[model samples]
Target: MLIVTTLIACILAVLFIRLSFGVIRLRRQYRVGLGSGGVDDLERAIRAQANFAEYVPIALILMACLELNGAPLWLIAILGIAFVAGRLIHAKGINQPPPHFSNRVIGMKFTITTLIVLVVFNLAWLLLQLWK
Candidate 1:
């Protein structure tokens, strides 16, 4: 479980770094001069960062719980990878034009499925612990 948590944390760290760099690149590209482009880029960066911050912690917490609850290590690994992949896809989709379902849908569903797994694992763990 600790291993899984560490792995997930590392992956998240990398994702955040990439996200920051992406925002910086966007700002540098669009905000080349004194104009609205810079402001728009900043707005987009803030929204992206805010959205990621809002969801990541919850996902991490649940993922940690799942790991601690004796969920299969493979599941943990797969979920961890899926989480990062989904975030990346979602990011790419959002950074582009309209109708970004291809990535967003997969990411959203992956996250939702992980949440459900966490819930089930935690409840089962609690029940087992209480049964003794």
Candidate 2:
């Protein structure tokens, strides 16, 4: 279980680093130090990166807790994979030169679906324990 969580963490960390690279590249390209310099492209890149950073931690924490609480391995793996896939899809969509319509929608769809599943499963599992 720990291995599962750690592996996902590593994968997510790689994604995070990749996003960071995008930020760094854009910052250098635009010659801006701290802000997006009123650049929509840069802003989108930053948001794409920031969005990933925002969502992944909660997802990972929930996943780890679910694992620690003895959630089924298959469920954890499925959700973990789905979440990562969603993030990857989202990053690609948002970082594209222009709006990437389908992938963007699908990416967010995957993300929302995964979150709902994880939350429902965790809550139900916890309540089952309490009921027991």
Candidate 3:
């Protein structure tokens, strides 16, 4: 749980750094009034933050529950790392130009992986308890 917590903190840190870069770019893009990417960047940043806030808490809660239900700590750590990596990939994808959607593809992979990990952990816990 502690490792997961730490990893989540790291994800937040990484997100902040990436968000700062985006914001800076947005500011420059809108220096005169508002350019094409300016509003898009602002919207993207806001939506990204909101989306992170919405999903991350639930992910953390699920991870914590798994821990409480006797899931291996190492598994939790791995999932946490996956979540962070997915977000990093997502950020990269968002920042890149067209045809370079690597970040988005990676982000989706990570997100799906994290979700699967959480589901499997919960289901395993349920089966273990039932068998006991």
Against the true structure, whose lDDT is highest? Answer: 2
Cα lDDT of model 2 by residue, 1-132, tens digit: 476778988999999998999888989999989879998888888999898988898898888888988888888999999999999999899988886978888888998899888899999989888898
* Candidate 1 clashing pairs, residues 3+ apart or interchain: none
Q: Give the per-residue lDDT of model 1 (tens digit) for 27-97.
A: 67776433336465555555555567677787788778777767678877877787777677666666555
Q: Write down the TM-score of every candidate.
A: 0.75, 0.94, 0.72
Task: Assess candidate 2 and give its TM-score to the true structure.
Answer: 0.94
Q: For each candidate, what is the lDDT?
A: 0.70, 0.89, 0.70
After superposition, the stretches of candidate 1 with alpha carbons farther than 4 Å from their true spots are: 32-45
Task: Provide C-alpha RMSD values for all models, in order.
Answer: 3.4, 1.2, 3.5
Q: Of models 2 and 3, which has the larger lDDT?
A: 2
Question: Least accurate stretch of 10 residues (summed lDDT) in model 3?
Answer: 32-41
Rate residue 86 of model 2 by lDDT: 96
Q: Give lDDT: candidate 1, residue 8.
A: 85
